[model samples]
Target: MFGRFAQFETREEYLEFLNAGVEFVGARDGEPIGRYNVAPGTRVLLLNQRDDKLHLDPVHWGYQPAWAKESGRPPLINARVETAATGRMFKPLWNTGRALVMADGWYEWKKSPDDAKIKQPYFIYHESKEPIFFAAISRFHPDALDAQEDDGFVIVTAASDKGLVDIHDRRPLVMTREASLEWLSPETTPERAEELAHDCAIPADEFAFHPIGKAVGNIHNNGESIIKRIYNPLV
Candidate 1:
């Protein structure tokens, strides 16, 4: 599961990367962003499609459906792609609420076979050094008092590819621009959406990973240093 990630680009860089005339909402000037850790519940940059157009907006990372609040269940941060299309919590949003969670890289912890207590962290990024767009779904809580803050999203995860299976059992559903557009397309049907979710897994060879300091395990630690590579024999 991808619970933490980094997006270390300026607003101009993001615009160039998206290559679309998009609007940015909820961004604060001089705020230390891009080079920090992003966690669940944190407001994050999201690329959503509406009426065949992509719009950039800030949304909460955790997903909370209207029924979940009444059920008193915690927010869902990750949805398994294997069952998302048929799952009770995710099925409703699978087709209509798709989005792209923008990120530079994501963190995964590798458990030590010799020592269960030792869990080493690693930062995984695209080999091309381009941004990774995680396939996700967004929903607006019906009972929300504030629309902006209440809109939430959850990353979709698929079985890890060969290279990353040792580090984790699952990885976020990373997508290319074409795959993302198909995913977020309003014209896409539920069957096609599910098919895309199951088939659009990024190849493991396209990614590179390196061990990082344990500082990333703590939510209090937030900075570029958190993702700094460190030598680890266990890795």
Candidate 2:
């Protein structure tokens, strides 16, 4: 359900937030800021097992198994939870490639009869002011694509929780510090995966949502105001 996100403005800002030590319940590696608009080709942070360590790397947002590129299907943005375990697009990784995607907040649109031509943007995140670590799942790139050009990733989405249901039909599988650590472990088993998926919802009282200006629709619009709370009746 997330289309737009807020990325850290500076590397230092990112380091500070990450160093706050709230997200390590899963993996320990840190990541840089990300693109405002996360699309298929966008590079995103991924946590994977490597030599007994959880390594975080930037990966392409689109997913294409090494042997399935010619399947004639466009890349998918979100992987459905109901079928991720058995779907042709997500099963391979479902067995053992879960990951974490770091984000400050995500954008959602609201449609109204009064403004058919525009959709209001809402920024959603933790009410605690902590950065959000969206739960993710990844697979090894079958091809040896350039590190900067060909890494791949996909976010897992679940049925909306009570507070978020009105905003979107599906919401990302947001990880808790504990669940992230469990999902990132190379030793994580299928049974463990099911447990993690079942517990991904954040309580309604733990989150905050606010309408922001239309400038956020433009990928070029990057500022704290994008997530600043605004009350506009038109929204």
Candidate 3:
């Protein structure tokens, strides 16, 4: 359910991960932390494929269709994998568009019945410490945007795997670094893209999750503590 995530602060840090080929998006300097509000308009880096080159773009955090007068939608942060192929909002882009939303880790909330205000935060990431590549589909709104504006993108998601099911029912579709390059390859055909999206999954054995402090709820709070393990992981 990638509701909130940590992101790189500078273009240098962002490109370093790119040069190293880390492909997930929405990374932060901190971990195991909480943010109160991480609404749209937040500036985040996006790695998009264009003319065979990986273009690093910083776009607003939410997906906004210029035509829509009101953005009543919940954060346009994730596109359900099951419906991405045929849904009007995601189909056109997935048919010919794709990208790698890079991230070191992501956050999800655990529902609590006793206290509605008490939501637990967990940081999910690879056991090996590699950046996660969130399989994404993006289309340029060349005709949809006003003049002088550039392109934007959205991330694709699916039901959570075994490792994350306990924390949330859904998770961002993730790809390994090797698969990320292929997904971002301009030469990849539409058929190839569909196969990649359909077949891709990060095994439960490869990832680790841990509960963290509730400080992460504040979008303004950014630091290394967010990723710190609040309780020793059972794994």
Candidate 4:
């Protein structure tokens, strides 16, 4: 459900990969953007549209608008792609808040057969280890440059089919670079954006998933070692 992800590229590399002429606000150039464990309630680098221009900003990872505050529901790190545009909490951002999450890969937990309490962790990435852009929707501040910690966003997720479902029932809606650019473009209509969510997502076979150590389950654990492929299963 996009609860955890990693981005090991530098700020320059991420921008260059997108190459969309995006303006950076909160982030500085040449900054080391490597993050092995990105959890909820923290700032995440996002490419979003504002003022008729593409921008890169650090927006909070949880999605909880002002209207939903009284409901006492916890902030959501994910929004189902099929319903996010029509969902009560996300409808407001559907038309204008489409965005892209810059992540190298994401993690999912598998319930072990040996024990109910133990959940095995898996790392999912492109087979070739290329960068991925996860589709998202955000409730960003009106001021693009001066984004607040409360201006939050949620990754759009779709139901998994075939083998990937073994890891998790859902996976983030990842798009190709061109489709991702279109997803964030102001010219693209909401109907087309929804279509892209379903039609343009990269297939499960394009990715590979392997079991990893359980240290990633803890938010404090960070480093290349945490993502090392362990031949053995913890469960």
TM-score of each: 0.87, 0.80, 0.77, 0.91
TM-score of 4: 0.91
Stretches of model 1 off by over 4 angstroms after superposition: 20-32, 141-145, 148-150, 233-235
Give one digit per residue, the lDDT tens place, for model 1 in 7-80.
Answer: 77665555456664434443434433555578887778777777745666678889776677888988889999
lDDT of 4: 0.84
lDDT of 4 by residue, 149-205 (tens): 458999999999878998889999998888898899889898899888888988899
Q: For residues 128-221, what per-residue lDDT tens digits would candidate 2 score against the true structure?
A: 7677766676765533555532246678887876777666657777767667667767687867787787765566557778887787777766
Query: Candidate 2, which segments miss by more than 4 Å at Cα?
Result: 9-39, 66-68, 113-117, 141-150
Better of 1 and 4 by TM-score: 4
lDDT of each: 0.78, 0.66, 0.65, 0.84
> Candidate 4 clashing pairs?
none
Per candidate, the number of residue pairs that clash is: 0, 4, 28, 0
* Model 1, C-alpha of 17: deviation from truth (Å): 3.2
Better of 1 and 3 by TM-score: 1
- TM-score winner, 1 or 2: 1
